[model samples]
Target: PLKVFNSEQIRNIGVGGHSGSGKTSLMETMLFAMGETTRIGATEQGNTISDYNEDEIERQVSINTSILHGEWKHTKLNMIDTPGFSDFYGDVVSGMRAADFMMIVVSAADGVQVGTERVRQMADRYHLPRFYVINKLDRENVDFDKVYHELRERFGKKLAIAQFPAESGPNFTTVIDVIKQKAYKYAHDKSGKVTEEAIPGNLQSQVNKIRNELVETVAESDDTLLETYFEAGELTEAQLLDGFKSAINRQMIVPVVGVSATANVGVHSLMDFIVEYMPDPTRRPAIEQDGATRKPSDSDPLSALVFKTVSEAHVGELSLVKVFSGILKTGDEVYNPGSSKSERIGQIFLLNGKNKKNIDQLHAGDIGALVKLKSTHTGNTLCQKGKEFELPPIEFPEPLISVAVVAKAKGDEDKIGAGLHTLHEEDPTFLVRYDGELKQTIASGQGELHLD
Candidate 1:
């Protein structure tokens, strides 16, 4: 029988990065490896989960955030793969809000780019724990040491490598797991599996230095560990693992893992790190306010934050949410503090791209969807009857591009307005306004492509 884990303790892994830096491709490989999808969706073909938008298909990029779920070795991984381009920054902002941990994707050859800096700033704003994955190490002319040094200089010393590339560029074959002191080799194919191997003979010294550094960092977490370290000179494996988890939960360390997501190299190891080191919802501290508090507990007064909204063909309207406290079940009556009214929890489902799995109750830490919630829009609050609590709303980027969209078909102006409103309902950043001076329906997004 397959074991089931509660949604309350599952990890919300957010994958964010620069466009063409392989964010979508990495998610595709992850889903494929976990048997979530029978085949991987390549960005070149425009079938990846995060790039499901029609325009994204033609442009071969992600236009909005896409949700995908998979089970990795008994841990449920609810991965939110977000668009990389600034044009769809709203999706990135919403993704960051819904996630408990972030995995920032950076290209090995490109080093640190503008998108990386932008996403990092967003992460900093929310005080979110982030893990950086240097992607595409299999490509040539990529200097691992130089890129690593530059990242440290640019991002700061708090950025440390948990896994280092054993060899880089075309000869990239394996990664030395800095914490484990083991090397993991990959299949020649992009979607292949990994094999455990001994640390490369030449890189053993470098690996030892990094491992010692990681151990020392972990040891600094507690007084007892610090004392033990001074007496013993080194921490045992079990002690190191415990200390690492504690350090990660406290945001004392941001671990770096290397991966060639296209070649499936280092992906599994990365997944292991996420499930093992990343903080789950239960571990996250509750947001406390004067009138309301949200802890990862079902017994607490029900309070869920609306982080995203989307318009679908047959579904009408969908509200994407993260339950910070209590349980939300179908037919449950909840208070929408944003609208100052009560709304019934219709159907709850786990969303994966366009596909959804109907579920009964969404626990804290889990990201799911509610169908046709009346009066509850994006950035709203839902709580138990008579208990009012409003979590902070997600901050979206300003629209930098605008265009006038007219109803091409005559006698459908009302329909066009309604359609645009529905679209805006799903995407908060999608602004639809009537330009009285110009007598046109003006829509604004982050860029020209975003308007389209």
Candidate 2:
């Protein structure tokens, strides 16, 4: 077996926000900062990795979830950048199921908007470990305190500020680390490099105050920590780190970090937090039908759950799978336990936002794609032959909007139907059916705007 370097805790992160909230731009910056891409591609130029679909480029909006992978601090990070519009909420739901944590990016200047509340409620429903990012701090009229207060009021006291912007809006050059009591002033380069510095002179007091609050909130999750904090009035850096991890692990607190994803501000720190704080698949107990607990491990027989399938024009179909136990490799024979049928495994590849790189093997708790598998659909489970287990498929929201598009010419009818089928295969949230009641082919999604 080839040793995998940089193997640490794996956390699938989901990011969602309102349309024009810079979700795509944030993802672009994150990829560029991680060295996944050399040049930071812009949405306006139709070259960003996440916005690869023709529709997304032409409309200048993300229509589907763009899944990407990044490695930070030698730990692999898989992220799904989701569309924020209501019409695309279905895509958001599908993405949420694959993520262990959710990052809700909000426009700092805009405060808590409609989609913020909606996505927050959705994340709560799924019991996902959620963090809020007040993005676009470089923009004018941005109020970090007001936005922070609003989020606290909405998300409750469990909402803690992990990082705060040093300055309010434009001229924002530094951020306060609520846990470390330090400041990071980002250099004005496309590659976001920050000079470690002391907390800004003017904000030192506020920084200390917020750091204390963060420590206290984190300590609330552990009795010993709470007692120590209440009596001693402070927590050491190591204690604060431990307490913060415990708080998030127990879902007792949600950390709010600041970032100008456009300016690449706080992006590296955000990625580091995700790797350091988020729980691995093994930490999450599996839900079983017979009331028995199962955690992903290599000791058990091979088991995998299919969460998505995308059919490329030239590469055929790729099945995005999460291995629950044992090992899966190229050319291994496995059974679709959900279907009670055996199928041959093909080549395995790690998907990087529409780009696929070949890999030989994937272990339990790993996410990757398999090429040309037969008799398996999204939500199906693959395991050793004669071993049967079923994982609940992702529950997507009901379509709230519908649209009917017809071919402009007679011969275009067949092409449109085939194209719709491919689209359905790519995104299960997109439902296509012949509406007998209306005598037209209707496509249903989260909302009208999404359908458009």
Candidate 3:
């Protein structure tokens, strides 16, 4: 959207999970449900909004993170869809750094995975509040309870079931939201249209049990809420809602939501929950560096962090940045603390995969792209001169595999060297260096797919 939103009206969510957990599909369903797209797109079809690149479409896997946006209930949601493979794990680190919170997706059929645990650890390290979305309920052998228990076993007992599929497999058309205590039956045509219904007769007891557990989870975090719950035997809807949000902000309640992205079920309710319960960008504390605290406020001194870089066909190099403080205006001069150089601010644009929406300015707590910076690269902080605050750089993981490389042709040595640097700039996890002992160039990464 071209309209500028304040920090209070923004939610920066980093979406991540296992490789086949249907993260891309989940992103597509959200965009469609938010009215940003005409219809849902499938991963197998290669037309999804998140996996738009040729390499990703050819392999039917996400290779890089795609920055996407959608307006839900007049609140701007800036989503970072990170790749699930460990090969491109650097993207997940950047996503966590840029997000105000994390949404960890898990496949209903697969349960927990290596990547799932990895992301949970990263979120804990960053102290970011997160929830789990159990996706692919329409797939065969999907068990929502099994996945829920697995998450509780690994994550914690504080993991509360927010929603669950009424029936799984090919007929998963309805999901019950524990908070709303209502059922949502969605259409099967990928239109994301749903009709509200009462709680099913057979599922009422289970829903009640889950709702009670949610109330208990929230009440445990506040003594006043606990006393009220004991005195009244049950909390009113308003009290429970406020307690739920407070518990979530304190990380005392970890909610699990069930969805079938392919069937376009339960996706809208998920967004509604986010708008109702999740904390806004203003809730997150500012990044403190150089004895300066950069809050997410338009009136504060300017500070922005470049977390990633990509080279578009006609756009040249685009630096994806998150404004941690103050407003970023076009044609302004900013200083790069990391590079110790002055860089001119150019045009700013909002992105949805390959598509770009031109905007002249970005408010604090918003993420956008700045075109053609001379001295700034990934992990650099841009701010007003003499009011310096260097944002902490994303700590990319160490490479797990290495290989020797050589030019295929005799005259292509310089070309190969230059190409590797460009690729390294795009992905810091992929490292290259000349081994003087072997007199050869060695390239390393998380795995063979990353090197290839």
Candidate 4:
């Protein structure tokens, strides 16, 4: 039986960071922990679920945003793994549109880099609630404390440590979860199995201090908790948990967790924190237009936005959409306000990287891919006829570099032009234009690598 998730049960999270920050590795560990995969996949080995593209595997980097889904603690999480390079930032923008929250991954050794700051700003632009995951804790010369302080100083005091390494480098096996007041030690075998243990005696004092700070910050989110704290000078674990979740949803507290993705240390704790604290899609504010707001509800009129289009060798073009208002089922007719054309919905699929699962329907706030749409492109709005509403299109940055493309074969002009058009459909950030004055076809993108 296929499990269907309601809007409130769905958590759409965008995972992003700078290149080599281990974003793909973290996702692979997550999928493994969730029982979605039998073993952890490595990016270096080109076997990661998210980096399935040939270009990405060959380059050992992600060039496009990949969507992966898993069930954690009875909650459905749609993880949007995005490219870290600025050259493919268009995919990042598209990923953000479909995500309800952002998980900013940072390398412990690298701290905050250019790509980290870019993703931070993108979270702000999208108004998505965000948290941080400091990855690569097992790397030599990595300073978790230094990176943690840097993130706090750069991002703001709102950034709070939710979990910290029990030890650094080769001994990095345990993480003390401040929120749950528990310690989890990962086996050295990288099997992702964690055993609960008491907080180490040496780290107890630090844990107490950090937990107090976390409770205080969470208490500030609600008046009742604040009053209780003032009276009792502390909060119970239950109260703190409730308050922390509220604070996280409102962006009042940005929790940070440390992990060694390759070693599988702290990955389970990180996934649990996400399932426990991250906001569900419905918790986000409603989408507004012309002083009107559209709440996520199956009873509301149908409204969805197409955020990505992928041209596959066998499937042609797949338009990935996020339902923001009502239920969308297979074989239903919908109208695209952007193209002003009516099209029948064909097969709907729930994406797990390149693997698609046939699903009968998707509720509001759920993301699914629609197959063989006639005229839909990225950022197009689809809805029931006469209930038309257009979402603001995703704003992609202007190309940073341009080059003239020439066809080597004499009769390959039309083929070149058609191929360029198809590529443009896949990536809106890449643009193609015919310069009449220069009599040359111009191709522009974020960088030379992107244009190539």
Candidate 5:
């Protein structure tokens, strides 16, 4: 939100993992480490930026996908913090649609779980490039090496070690970055401040083994690099970076790193890795819908997807959109293919939780919001007024459970019906219908929690 950034300078990252893996906390830690916030908020404390909704505060779980942004190393990272509960998987699917890369967090204490596997499958369906983040390294009885191998066993041999904890549990304050061959020791004060130090002598052999494996994996990703590696016996650090990125982009290798989100340990280093290795929007394939392809570039015609809609207090309805091509500017009338009507674009803003920062325009590959647009809803495609094309709408899973609902008082049926309709628009997985035989309104979703 500081300045208009081009497509290359931006990263639309989606953060997701198993429930209680600290996905929400990891997001807050990154924001705090990057100076977006002064301190990290605990989910139990109910003050984190992403879980700002009322129900989330009471339940201490992320129920909605919140858009957050932070600046790191001169790059704008637009993060989507998604709900981890399976009942809310619809939001995760929608969040993945806007992301260029995925950070799937796994808790060292809990290891890989069902939610983790489910989200991984969703990312695979999108063919997204993702890396594993082993979080909660400071918890007792959590073994970094064991959890890492668990990842390798479950996800295959492509799991390359990017970082390993020097120590786990209570004394976990240091992590060795194998690529950089350096150690980052965070302050015990939970301030996210770190001091660079030399790698410990005790772990030198393990670090060397992992670094060699990483280099070999990178070199094998490209024929030229492989030939050079065989001739030179090794790839330079510069070559390692170049080939590592290519390997990741091609899904030839999936890097894994360790972190303690609660301690704010290694979060900063993870952000650095993302900015350096993850693929930018322009590097990925062009988005094609209905036989029309649109590259992620500023010069392409105006085309953006409305992924989510939030009915904000005192702000009317806000549409969250990710621009695939060209710039979405204020006052530009755009066409909504779903509604078959023209929407007059008005004020545009970048959102961090409930906080909205007024902005003039958003560049390609950037995610932002438009205020009070008529005839536009979630899953709608907005393009140049004369461009009659539509981006593919987000595909969500089917509802798994249904329950009947009745007005608490008579004559409140109209209000409840309107509210349920809006909820369906926001969450496509939540289905509602009137059961004529039962003479009742049946609302369906994934589970009991979803209905509650």
Candidate 6:
């Protein structure tokens, strides 16, 4: 395993979509394909890495933003798996703030829904590079063409198909890569093995048409490519690939791919596409505060943002951070401007779901967790003592539901108070207040499950 990664070799992607859209399944497939897990664990069985929390297992939904990572083709992919329900949208906001790009998972059978648009708006707000994965293609009556067209109409014409299903429903086994102009058929055993084949004779015309559109989209991103396309009437594959990467980074083109996460079809192609087209952390916009920008580079002064705080059974408080500039090493002293306090960092761990692997240092554009900070909370900036700047705090929605807390046993009120305070520290979206008029302790959250 690579102990450290440079800025260009790291890709932070936020996996978000509506409930039951198979975002977790897609993440599980990616981890399995990358050899991070020996076997793919299903969410229903409560064995998946990301949804390991007890609450998640009982609810069968992601309650917190899970930080998961895997190395694909030597490039480290840090995936932020977020909740889809509106009640837990605060987690989605944090995931968006931490990711360099977003992969919005949409169900082919369901097409575009309310949660899909909500996540799209969040990505747009951050101006992150976006892509679409139309999942569950093996389900009965699934229509790739319909979803593809609907995405273009709803999002924009800049949305283009990078890969499409060769067939629908149970027969869905092959995907035609528009960029590569090749068809890949998945094996019968669902091992993620694919046999390359030429484009089907009947689909050749359609492929050519979409391929041309893709070429045009790529060419328009660069002046040289556009002039060459006009002069030569075409572009070579090398030129198209170079321009496509640039176009994707500049947000000129949004590529859509098809996949069946459960069937393990087209997932390999999707992972390859991410490595090929998704921009690295350096290519993304710099971290800015008060008109000061910190580009992603190890040479810059140390600066990192604490995006999440999790309390474990024994480890205590763990602050998850993304290094926006310079490097963070274990035992370094940094100041948190939000908390107006100084703290010493202890051990730094690269997060894999609930698991943590110790690492000596984390460079710019990397995400990791530090244990036992003195006063830093979520949305705080930690940097060199004299060089302090804060990133914008995540905007969480106001609580819409409220409930009164009453102790079942006398003298347990102090315990409940302490527990509520701890919960508030862990989740900023949860609010607790002592109602003087009602003479009750009131707890509020976006919804009932949050309070629960």
Relative to the true structure, candidate 2 has a C-alpha RMSD (angstroms) of: 2.4
Model 2 TM-score, 2 decimals: 0.92
Please give the TM-score that candidate 5 achieves against the real structure.
0.98
Better of 2 and 6 by lDDT: 6
TM-score for each predicted model, relative to the true structure: 0.94, 0.92, 0.97, 0.97, 0.98, 0.96
User: Tens digits of per-residue lDDT for model 3 on 123-183?
Assistant: 8999888899999899988899999999999988889988889999999999899988999
The TM-score measured for candidate 1 stands at: 0.94
Error of 5 at 412 (Å): 1.4
Higher-lDDT candidate among 1 and 6? 6
lDDT of each: 0.83, 0.79, 0.90, 0.90, 0.90, 0.90
Q: What range of 10 consecutive residues in model 6 has the weakest lDDT sum?
A: 1-10
Note each model's CA RMSD in angstroms.
Answer: 2.1, 2.4, 1.5, 1.3, 1.2, 1.6
TM-score, cand. 3: 0.97
Pick the winner on lDDT between candidates 1 and 4: 4
Tens-digit lDDT string for candidate 2 (67-180)? 788777777777877887777776777777677778888888788889898888888877877888888988888888888899888779998888888886767778787776
Show model 3 residue runs off by greater than 4 Å: none
Estimate, for each residue in 1-452, the C-alpha lDDT of model 4 and write its tens digit.
46999987899999999999999999999888888899888988999999998989999989998889989889888998899988998999999999988999999989999999999999988888899999999988898889989998898888889999988898799999987778999999999888999998888899999988888888887899999999999998789888888888888889999999999999989878888889887787877886766788888888899999988889999999999888999899999998999989999998878988899899999998999999889999998888887888999998999999999989999999999999899899999999999999999999977987
Instruction: Spell out the clash pairs found in candidate 5.
Output: none
What lDDT score goes with residue 57 in model 1? 90
Tell me the spans in candidate 5 whose CA falls farther than 4 Å from its real position. none
Q: Scored by Cα lDDT, where does model 3 land?
A: 0.90
